[model samples]
Target: MSGTELTVTLSGATAADARAVVRVLEPAFGQAKEEPPTSEDVTVHTARFEHDPADRAAEPAAGGPGHLSGAVTVTVQGAPEAVSMARESLAHAFTAQDQGSVSGDQEQEWQLLLEP
Candidate 1:
């Protein structure tokens, strides 16, 4: 992925719950390539977002009123700045707890637990 691209992974949640989280992030990063859950038994959903710094809105949009059944584990992977921006966006939408994160030379991975 590019520096401005972020990959969001949601696990231990239903498809609807995953979509709710993606909706919260759409405004900050624009539309994302969302991968629908493969089957009813599937527990993981993924979305890819490309953030354009030049086109960012002055004020990020607030998350919608969609509700989740339970807490969702979210994993965001991207460049350091991209991951940070995504974390901030998720915080504005849900009750997020910082789990932990790992950083490398060109990329970073952050894990968060989000509650409705």
Candidate 2:
């Protein structure tokens, strides 16, 4: 399907947060073309992971409300419909964990801020 392309970026994330984000995105993005087919419903146009290994050591251990000394930004771009689906999935994820996400829209780009 044809739709506006959009990017979602998550900032101030911990390794745990990163893992959570992937769990939510994987269903929307699906496996690489080389991989066997799975139960994904949407296909992502692009996905990128950003993080620094040096900062990993400094991050607080996963559990309870975590703190962020650094960030792991995961960006995903896809059609509007797919992006919307991803957003809903993401919302459910954070809500389930009692974590809150601050989102803003600017020039069709959506940014999500996560704690811990």
Candidate 3:
């Protein structure tokens, strides 16, 4: 199946999906032309993170307003080599023209049950 290819048309994506898509934006636009007024009609032919480290659900949870139909998560368990490639694509979409200061951590916890 590695020989096969898939395309993700991010044209009509909902706001929630846009949030998730932003992670892969950088690399997505790296190859596109730089024209006046950016085009939100972006497509990421190559995405990186299939099995999310966070909720493991890149798609919106069931019963949500923006549940992606016919949507499937690309499992990376079989091929560990694709992770880096995917990340590279996203980096292009995000940074766009400017390789801005990117220094942040993806935290797993955000609760405040106990005050430290």
The number of the candidate with the highest TM-score is 1
| Candidates in descending lDDT order | 1, 2, 3
Q: Write the number of the candidate with greater lDDT, choosing between 1 and 3.
A: 1
Backbone clash pairs in model 3 (N, Cα, C under 3 Å; residues 3+ apart or in different chains), count: 13
Q: Please provide TM-scores, in order, for all candidate models, with all chains considered together.
A: 0.85, 0.42, 0.22
Worst 10 residues of 3 by lDDT: 107-116
Task: For candidate 3, write residues 1-116 as lDDT tens digits.
Answer: 22211122333333344444433432322221222223345432223223332423332222212223223222111122223333334333332122122222421111111000
Task: Give me the runs in candidate 2 sitting further than 4 Å from their true place.
Answer: 1-8, 32-46, 49-76, 96-107
Q: Taking the tens digit of each residue's C-alpha lDDT, what string does model 1 give over 1-116?
A: 23378899998888888878788888888878755454657778888988776776645566655478899999999978778888888887888899999999989999999887
lDDT of 2 by residue, 13-73 (tens): 5444544565554544442223222323433323342222232232222233333434444
* Candidate 3 Cα lDDT to native: 0.28
Error of 1 at 115 (Å): 1.5
Q: What is the C-alpha RMSD of each candidate to the true structure, in Å?
A: 2.5, 13.8, 16.2
